[model samples]
Target: MAKLVDLTKKPYNLNADQIKWVEDTIAGMTDEEKVGQLFVNLFFPGSDEYSGNEFTNQEIVEKFHIGGARYKGQDSVQVQGLLNELQSASKIPLLVAANCDSGGDGATNDGTYIASGAQAEASGDTSVAYNAGYVSGREATALGVNTNFDPCVDILMNWRNTIVNTRAYGTNADSVIKYTNAYLEGLTQSEIIQCIKHWPGDGTEERDQHLVLGVNELSVDEWEDSFGRVYRNHIENGVEMIMAGHIALPEYQKALNPSLKDEDIMPATLAPELIQDLLKTKLDFNGMVITDAAHMLGMTSAMRREDYVPLSIAAGCDMFLFFNDIEEDTMFMMNGYKNGVITEERMTDALRRILGLKAKLNLHLKQAEGTLLKDKSELEVIGCEEHLEMGADAANKGITL
Candidate 1:
């Protein structure tokens, strides 16, 4: 067993064996290296072009020791290049991930528009959901995406809820659980870590957390009755990570102690009671716990809103999925440590969780899988049937309701 490494306090201490591994094997990471573990950013495949503006490229990841990436396209080659660059560039090897919600198609166009597994279940023949998930995992694994932000476990409680519409299987918790497990089986069996998202259930909320803070109408017990099953079940089954969103459940919101209640129980990304207390303590999730995106207004950011990095840290988030707010989180957290708002202990705790998860991916001190470049012809399989068949299998075999 590897020696326990602690990051809760500064002047951190890992046993000598652990220290040698992190320092000697991990390119001698400093506090900066520890900080980089807190991020997972968006990717534009070929380079870094977002909204027609190119703010970052392969170089930024290399220079900053970025943790991982949330890829956004089907250009497998470009995705490969970016992943390879990000992983190879980091002072410590990186964890390359993406939001392959409906498979990589959600990430890129070269992918098939296989109906989300959730939609497949509603239409019957769970095979559709299964195949879609399976195919997507295969496609990504072949292309080099190590982790997938998928199998949206948000229980579909409100049919009128515009956001989750087709994203969820149905309002039935059992249905969601079955299909979710199948989706995970296909993806994890492929060796890609799957991140079931929008914790505490975003299905009951009518608003989209991306645009504004969303709220769940169910009380804590009601939520546990309806949707919390998905979250707990998945964690129990050993999912590697979970992404909390900007939605608030009144029960959770009302329970918050001072300093936090002022934020409206806000996004799960910024709430400690939700992230730490609910997720870790209550739900017993021991894997990686990441935020949706710091730049999202529904959530908090270091630039526009007050800096939320410290609060997110103190509350118990292991990583920040960044679409455009890395520098600020890095700079602000650095300041938090120096200024004393976020103690060294909190910093180390966050870093340990981050490092521990990435390490689970075998991404630090040890290189994980998906390093080989695909043959040019493998590109043809990007949106092909064998892959589609896999998704169909997932949908058919996985969905029971």
Candidate 2:
């Protein structure tokens, strides 16, 4: 009768009410089941059919019992079917999420209309960013996708950052702040939660963390200018979750360990001093603070030096995200937990954080004794006339060129 819930102790960290909820939920899990909540993987179900034979994903889903899956480029009906399958297989309701940050197109392509963040800037309408996020939220809801990870709040001070160039609203701090806040506002308005990201800001360094764990050499003041402005505003405006970037800041070096030089902590993902000390503690983000993607170069040490996840979670990441090739890394985390490197308390912490968000967003389905999501036609919510008009007007406002 020993269950995963038994592995987790009577949670005392949360309020009395929350602790009660955690206890009730934890009681249903086995040790392996509890460990699974530590992550959300973004698996591309190859060619999008993802049905009949879920192909290779079956192993990851069946063996791993993952907490959630953040899918990419999955068309509408296919997404519904896959989600239905996932929910049925899991003992607990799986926490399903998607990118959908710019527009819901981040997931459903044709199902959601697209908006160029650059175009929104050229349009000079801040509301455009808001509307874009709103449209993303509405479209995602139609397909049963809830958590929207977008409206990247990076200042994007470097025009050459290819990954961020168009995705970001613009180059100016004031404009980025104005538009990002509006974008978050719109996403929030639609009853969907927004995760404003690349926290501590992804703007200072020119390199993409996706390819390299880029370091920001700016002084504390300069670093603040590049990233702080917009993030401060994001927090003030109530963006619920903020993602930590892989980029490093030389200025916060001493905080990482009053002794080690900048070379020792090139990537923030693995450094608790930088992310936990500087970000979570100093910034006081009481909400969820998640990692960018564990599989990215930012979190991965060189193939020879690869040892970051244990330290990353200990650093204060509430959740770790993985895009693809998930098994290897997920195994590492699970093994770490099994070995005591990652405590059950830590795994439970992530579960509580992720589940807490699901609850907050009202993503858990309602009034459904039976309605095959596939049998439904909710995909029509995206790009409908009302959304398109709102998007067009907002795009016009935020776009500059």
Best by TM-score: 2
Where model 2 places Cα greater than 4 Å from the true spot, the runs are: 1-19, 45-59, 302-306, 323-327, 362-375, 394-401
lDDT of 1 by residue, 1-401 (tens): 11223432222223454444544544455767666667776766665665454456665676556777777654667776666666665656666676666775764567755667456676566556665677667777666677788878887777777777778876788888887777777666576777888876777757877677878888767878877777778877877778887777667667644444444556677766777777777776666678877766677522244367766665577777773555656787667667776667666656665665545545543444544334456567677867666556555555455
Q: What is the C-alpha local distance difference test score of each model?
A: 0.66, 0.64
Query: What overall lDDT, based on C-alpha atoms, would model 2 receive against the true structure?
Result: 0.64
Over 1-401, each residue of candidate 2 has an lDDT whose tens digit, in order, gives 10121212211123445445555776677777666676676655444333333445556666777777777665677776666666565545555677775677776866555466776677777666767777787777776665677877766677877667877877778878777777777776666656777766665556878788777676777766757667666666656677777777766666447787646765666666666566555654445667787667765653322245555665667677763435556666666777776666766665666666654543343313443233456777766888777756654555443
The CA lDDT at 114 in model 1 is 62
Residue 80, model 1: Cα distance from true site in angstroms: 1.8
How high is each candidate's TM-score? 0.84, 0.84
